[model samples]
Target: MKIAILGTGAVGTTIASRLVEIGHQVMIGSRSKTNEKAIEFVQKFDRNISNGTFEEAANFGDIIFNCIKGEFAVGALKSIEKIIDNKILIDVSIPVNTKNGMPFTLIPELCNTNSLGEEIQKNLPNTKVVKTLNTMWSTLMMTPSMLKDGDHTNFICGNDTEAKETVKILLKEIGWKEESIMDLGDITGSRGMESVLHLWWKIWGSTIGTFSIKVVN
Candidate 1:
């Protein structure tokens, strides 16, 4: 798969590195991609990843992963809306503004955690949007274990079955097995799933240490 990574932060770098390691063509998109780590990535892994602007990455990818922050995620796509027709978009974003945020799902989901995924789904009506990878820290995105493998839980919800399946395949390639991941039905569930991140922040941001929730049989 031709994967476009739309941010060069930790999440984007981690995903791109893993995908490239698995022999996928990855284009990393960033505001200024020629900087230190980006240059090092190009030099270190010549065949796997190529750096480009957002427009270049969007056009080059068969599947687009929007790993940018929630603030920039939608705008990044809109800037290149013409290029993202009918493509599978994997959104790893959360909608939280520092000052006015509450829990992921308060009374009526009233937290600053409004529906970021739904917003993206709305933005690119033609594009299939699947929300995953936002619930956990980047440490466990593809890898159930560690940097790129092991056991972890990441909730994925989307309106399109086929698009969801495609993400599942890629998830498998990234070492996620059937029981390790869950599908919470449709894209709107991201509103609730994001609460996991808030819970995580409170724990980690405090001193609760590394914590994970799993479904027990």
Candidate 2:
């Protein structure tokens, strides 16, 4: 499969590397094709992976992963909305306010009543947007075995059932367990999913290493 990762950040790079390792053709996208980080990433990966501008990646990919920072995600995706129409877009970004280089708060305008997932879906109406993987660290997103041998839970929500199923397949390929993944109904569930970051960050500070939750009866 051809995959486009729309960011040069740790999350995007980590996912791009994993996809390439799993034999998928991957493209890392950024604000510009000349971005030093994206270039470095391509150099470090196999020939199956490449780098390009966001628009170019969108056109090149069969599936698009929106890993752009929450603050910039909507605007960046909106710029190439038409190029990604009808493609499955997996959004793993949450709007965060970094104060003194630390993520201190979720964006005020995008909480409770609205969410980044909804915004992306609203802006790219023709694209199928599935929200997942925003609640944990980037490394954990790709290698769930780091915790409980991949037993920890992951969440996914989207308006399109077929799109969500497609994402679930990718999740399994990347080490997530089918029984461990919970479907929170639709894109509106992203509110709670993104909001959970509040608790995630708090737990992160006190924990010795990475941690995630599992729902059990």
Candidate 3:
């Protein structure tokens, strides 16, 4: 599969490297074609991995991974809206803002009633958007098994049933089991998932450890 990762940050680079390791074609998309981080990523990986501007990467991918920071996501996608039509977009971003050097915080206007996932979906009505992996760190996003026993849970939500199923397969490839993945109905459910980040931040600070949630029956 040809995948486009729309950010050159830690999350996007980590996801792109993993996908490339798994034999998928990956392009790290950034605002500039000469982005130093993006260039370094391609030089570090095999020929199957590359880098480009946002629009160029969008045009190159069969599936687009919106890995940009939550606050910048909509504007980034809008820049390449024409090329991403009908593509399945796996959104793993959270709408977080940092204030006065404080720990990460969610944007008040985009939480509860609205979420980054829904906003992206609304902005790109023609794109198939599925939300997942926003609740955990980028490393854990692909290697959940690194944690003790890997029994933790992850959530996904999207209006398109088919798109969700497709994302499920990709999740499995990265070590998520069917039983460990919870589908919380449609896109609206993202509100709950996004909200979980607040608690997640607190937990991360309290324990100073890597952890994720598990849905116990």
How many angstroms is residue 86 displaced in model 2 relative to the true structure, after the best TM-score fit? 0.9
TM-score of each: 0.86, 0.97, 0.96
For each candidate in the order shown, give its overall lDDT on alpha carbons.
0.79, 0.91, 0.89
Better of 1 and 2 by TM-score: 2
What is candidate 3's lDDT per residue for 1-217, written digit by digit as tens?
9999999989998999889888899988999999998998799964799899999999999999999988899998987888999999999988886552466677887888899899999999999999999899989988988886678889999999999999999999888888889999899878988888779878888886788989899
Rank the models by lDDT, top first. 2, 3, 1
Task: Give me the displacement of residue 135 in model 1, in angstroms.
Answer: 1.4
lDDT of 1 by residue, 1-217 (tens): 8999988888888888889988899998887756566667667786868998888888899999988877677788877887887999999877555455664423333234557788788888888999987777675775667632445577899999999999999988988877778899998787877666667777776765455666555
Model 1 is weakest, by summed lDDT over 10 consecutive residues, at 103-112
Lowest lDDT 10-mer window, candidate 3?
A: 97-106
Give the Å shift of residue 214 in candidate 2: 1.2
What RMSD, rounded to one decimal, does every model reach?
A: 3.4, 1.2, 1.2
lDDT of 2 by residue, 1-217 (tens): 9999999988999999899988899988999889999998799864899999999999999999999999999999999989999999999998886643666678887889999999899999999999998888999999999999988889999999999999999999999989989999899989999998889988988899889988786
Ranking the candidates on TM-score from highest down gives: 2, 3, 1
